[model samples]
Target: MSAPGKSIFFMDLARNAGWCEGRVGERPIYGSERLAPEGSDSPAVFAGLLRFIGGRLQAFKPNLFIYEAPRDPRHMGGQTNLAAIRMLIGLPAVAEATAYACGVLDIREAEAASIRSFLLPPRPKGSGRRKEGELKSDVFKQIVSLGYEPKNTDESDAIAGWLYACSILDGRVGAAATPLFSQT
Candidate 1:
């Protein structure tokens, strides 16, 4: 159960998107939604994503909504395919538009790296750099240690983002003074 007021919703958007919903001092409920079939065309996939976001917005009625900001393909070190690049770029735009249409105006985005840095411990002085998979595993372990069972990496990532947002909203960490843009 969550404390009263200041509910938040966090999402990690993708074809198999993950979401977490909770209030300030509570355990969030999180799970993933497959937006469409594996190789569906972009329009169909996006339509499914739109409906999912809209429905969740209405059902949860959260005070603030946050999602992991998608990284650009260039920054992905050439490992991502064109199809994935398109989906990653388009998902947030669809989510934001859906939130606006649903009258949930206080939307924000946090970079995956930022969430990682906030939730995971710093690397030890002489341990050499850890790979991305290692970091993700550490994050999964951390969340599990906190007594949450995440079904997959996507859900864990959403939980991590939610944890980061909760830290900021609870005054444990400082967020940027201004949002990306104001609705008004």
Candidate 2:
């Protein structure tokens, strides 16, 4: 378990990144920010994302930093968009670097599937795989169950990840919550 009185900052990184930050027992503050704008190149997007994360880190000064791990490209089925995949992979790298630069030594990552499992109800025994929209709706519902109204799927994802992180910090979860990266 993490130290008492620790604060955490969680993110669901993408072209439009979602973020949540607060102490474990308090109400978390969450929102999404657009990292890639029309006509912007990859470098510009990375720079903007860096600034966005860095600014928040400076503002909150959380003790721990956690973000959703990007899906493996090989598991993305027919998604062959190289640029999109690169951006997805780059976001966490940028977030990790920003956390280290900001002096937040404890950094970790959570899998999207793991977060969904921790927050969402189990599917029915005979139910098949859910479509993307259905999963987003379920995530939204889970966030609502936690008493927060997320503005979008991105925000909902970040909040769900935040809750999962809290569970890990409090020792309420076990192996399923192991960090993708841990410095403590």
TM-score of 2: 0.87
- Residue 39 displacement (Å), model 1: 1.1
- What pairs collide in candidate 2? none
Index of the highest-lDDT prediction: 2
RMSD of each: 7.0, 6.0
Local accuracy by lDDT, each model: 0.82, 0.83
- lDDT score, candidate 1, position 78: 91
How many steric overlaps are in each model, in order? 0, 0
Q: Write the per-residue lDDT of candidate 2 for residues 44-103, one digit (tens) a residue.
A: 788988999899999999999999998888888877588878787778888899999999
TM-score of each: 0.87, 0.87
Candidate 1 clashes: the total is 0
Worst 10 residues of 1 by lDDT: 175-184
Residue 68 CA displacement from its true place in model 1, Å: 0.4
